[model samples]
Target: MIRPFAALLALAALFSAPVLAAPAADAAATPSWSIAIHGGAGTLQRKNMTAEEEKAYRAALAAALDAGAKVLAEGGEALDAVEAAIVLLEDDPRFNAGRGAVFTWEGTNELDASIMDGRTRAAGAVAGVTTVRNPIRLARSVMDDGRHVFLSGAGAERFASQRGLEPAGPEWFATERRRRQLETMKAERVGALDVEFKFGTVGAVARDQAGHLAAGTSTGGMTGKRWGRIGDAPVIGAGTWADDRSCAVSATGWGEFFIRAGVAQAICDRVRLAGEGVQQAADTVIGEVAAMGGDGGVIVVSAEGETVYSFNTAGMYRGRADSTGTREVAIFAGD
Candidate 1:
């Protein structure tokens, strides 16, 4: 009986001596970070996506994830990884951004992109720029260099050109599908994408090899947008925002309401001020955004390494890859 009592006391000492919460591991040491990207969010019809097209999309998404993962693996900062990953998508014609961006109403290509650094709260954006091939890179350059948070139109192009950035002609932005889409919109005579129609963009949120967090978004706006229409992509808090203290967010869908609601920043605020977990904050914000008549989705990653793909629409084109090499791609909310 004494022996048992002695053993119980030993166990009690082991259990009761206040175990500190695993000394909050160094952000660099814990393989507790991940990255996710989206091609866009819209009413994607499986019927419209042939197996070949779907396969191509999967490959493109995988390539983007790997590109970012490479940066992370090399101990690059999360912002660098996010930019690298998004550049791949921007270059890919499969997505409706960058090289294959949709056309503006006057039969021109206007591009917008924004980037945020969670650690510093520094951000950069460009709107209506027609020449810069990689808007995300240019945005990073703006953030790193000047005090300016945004640039627009020809001035933005000139700034990019001065930096020795490659300049592509307006024709380079044209894609047969987009041209046809423009025609379709003209026939329908609607503004932006009709509520009946849908579209998506490509984005990425990354934690680099050093465990720093960053997020980026790239889009061609909508297929037939008008009047200097800029979606969430160019709005710092609406389209993209990141902070090491909260999380990184990139949104897609009805850019108008998203802009009105400050979608991405709203989510971060909910988590930071309300103490909501990543998923809960994302769900609540997304729900509220949808209730406000906004339709679309968001890709969010929290500081504790949580990821959420939240949307009110039927589907969102999203992909995620983690330190464990676990990768997931989904269009539909289920399966």
Candidate 2:
């Protein structure tokens, strides 16, 4: 047997030695930081989109990724990064959150958004707000205010004003495309869609260098929603959830099913408690939504920095970027 002094010296050296380099592939598999975002999920088909339309969409997604990545690279909080990405998407009229929001049955715009911080498990949401420039920012403000988890209608707007949040006129949200969609719904004389629902929610999820996770989602609700309708986007556990113990999730699709299924929290429960991978948890949850006669998608980022996207629709406008120089943006199923 070795002498005790020699054994002690050996142990010291072993402990002080430099760490071995991980394999390149393994290192790449796990980035120092990661972010993922989605514009919406629906019956998106290549044939229905023009080449220019596809190009514009890809560019918009890429821009959102850039905004979020810049923050994470500078060691920003995941909550801020998520808000940054979503703000860009909200301003882009191609998506259905802020500027391009769909119209209510009464021919007006109503916006909804929610944000969660995994480190503290704090969240805030606003629904049926008409004039916030970016609902995601208002959501962040609400979360920071330390009171109330959800706010709605004129009350939410008053809270926004009190917080000095940016305000926009209703006309700022009235896009030509949204008007056309509202007209289509009215001409068809259908109160709501049975099969032609385009789930137009925009969202982001991210993990920062500090290991904090955050998620945020913003939406204009459905094309012809009525009676001050609110979708999953503004419901914390349904459309958005973040917990340091699990992952951060932002969901888009049929809000009713998502609210009933509690999609975001469901994904987190499977991952946090059951030791399931992020993608596996997301897939299982999305599959259940489909079985329930609803279809949509979610983007999730785990505490361990794993990014996942799961959807049951034909396509979801999605993108991801990480510290490892990996960049991806796609709208099709396989892409």
Candidate 3:
């Protein structure tokens, strides 16, 4: 029989004994994951939008973020989450992409899209495609099935059709608001400006539980664009690029500078080679490549579940949601 003092000592010892912590769970089992998205980049302002219009933009952004977060929570690949989020924006007319894309000089709508798988360095893109409803989906399909890296024009449309992608009439993409915007730009003689409106495209980058990275970009092409102009959207390194060892980047801005600098891939390369943080690498690229003579912004997601969004413009339509339920959305730089 233990004395009262002895019993008290045993209790103290038991309480003080190293509470054996459960074995640390696998990182994959408790993956550190995140999702980020952008509507586009440019001079977004409150004066340029009405209350209802702002609400629409917010709602659209929220919806996209929700979709992406859901995918990440389900152990989906980053590519799937990014694409799922972007498709919502692509299908919405509130932005200049997919179903609501801007018109070309010939009064026709042209679309561009790209997707990159960080794990494989595999990418696909479509340019000057007029009939496909969802160009990004078609791009992914190409990456998965076709041997080609890029497809353009009527040929791309044919390939999309062969792949069972839905085709729509040209009228299906037109919007009175967009037409007026084009007319206004033309009137101001600034239609040729280097994508200052920020109405470029939708992009997403994600890191998943499986330690994978992916990126995607979808655009209606440049506003009031001419001569079969293809922006960086379809140029893998320029507009969209990803690599698991580095980071995934999606760019929105002056297509010419983006293409010349390989904005997306350049950011990734900086991280892989220089060991820069996601924000540092992204800022360096944007300032060097995009802000040199061009104008625009980008969203980046690193392998460690870090996100960086930087732009020179007044604002960029952007949002982010992480595994910890941190959800935030913005339209302007200040937002």
Candidate 4:
């Protein structure tokens, strides 16, 4: 009943109408900046520690958290936040780094530290450096220098000097408590030192407002360590790793086992390729390490700000802070 011209007009109108393509899939929202830290993990027992000792430890952890949290709150890079937090711990005589570093078999301090940037995958590390005031700061210098990922022994000290990092004398690193502990270990004449002495390495992981992640670890190595021993704390994939695609990790535990397990990288791989959550990945890895006769713990932060503190030991000194003003510090295993 319709004329041919009318039919042609109807078709033209139908074709002329704009068609909306299906809306593009919504992108995932970036996470708010967050930070997490660990003093160390070992056979810590509440009954074994005095009230005064516990208070001192808790206060130290809080101060470290504040240092990193301040950086995150002010929109600073995650790398700087981690560095700031570690510097404070390194300066404090309470922890087994810097001023309170444990003595080696030769009765001297050998420091180790590493730092990583998730955005660029850049990393820096130093091992067996005796005189650097803050090994974490020197590690950052090595990272920013862009020439090498690791430097060790006298070479690291030379690099520190070249970078103008201040050097501290041997006396600056020897604390009376650490000296007494070393003496006790020597008296025991045991093949392995007590696990209690092993828990003192300090580490931090952070996510910035820009969605970047960074991780760092610093330690005085192990008490009575011999032959220039180096632990996972100075090893990139073992003690520290950060990647924008997955997560940032800082580990403190048995360095030998952590190195074998590639703890940091393993955690990220689980998150990146297996679609596992941060906590699951960390827990699984820690369990595996425990099964292998290693004890320790790790702090992890995903790109989206999810965090996990996983350890097989009795306790780990840890804390967390986020953009929402949430902050917590804990030391006991149940806590």
Q: Whose TM-score is greatest here?
A: 2
Give per-residue CA lDDT, model 4, range 1-335, as digits (tens). 22354443332232221111111122243347889999987767798899999999999999999999999889999999999999999999888888899889899999999999999999999999999999999999999999999999899999999889999999999988888777877776542235243467999999999999999999997888899988899999999999999999999987888899999999999999999988888888887776666668899989988666887666788888787656788887677
Error of 1 at 273 (Å): 1.0
Ranking by lDDT: 2, 4, 3, 1
TM-score against native, each model? 0.88, 0.90, 0.88, 0.90
- In candidate 2, list every pair of residues with a backbone clash: none
Q: Where does the lowest 10-residue lDDT sum fall in candidate 1? A: 15-24
Candidate 1: segments with Cα more than 4 A from true spot:
1-30, 191-196
Among all windows of ten consecutive residues in candidate 2, which has the lowest summed lDDT?
A: 15-24
- lDDT tens per residue, model 2, 32-75: 88899999987677987899999999999999999998999999
The global C-alpha lDDT for each of the candidates, from Candidate 1 onward, is 0.76, 0.86, 0.81, 0.85
lDDT of 3 by residue, 109-153 (tens): 999999999999999999998898888899998899859989999
Worst 10 residues of 3 by lDDT: 15-24
Q: Give the C-alpha lDDT of model 4.
A: 0.85
Superposition TM-score, candidate 3 onto the true structure: 0.88
Model 2 misplaced stretches (Cα beyond 4 Å)? 1-28, 190-197
Model number with the top lDDT = 2
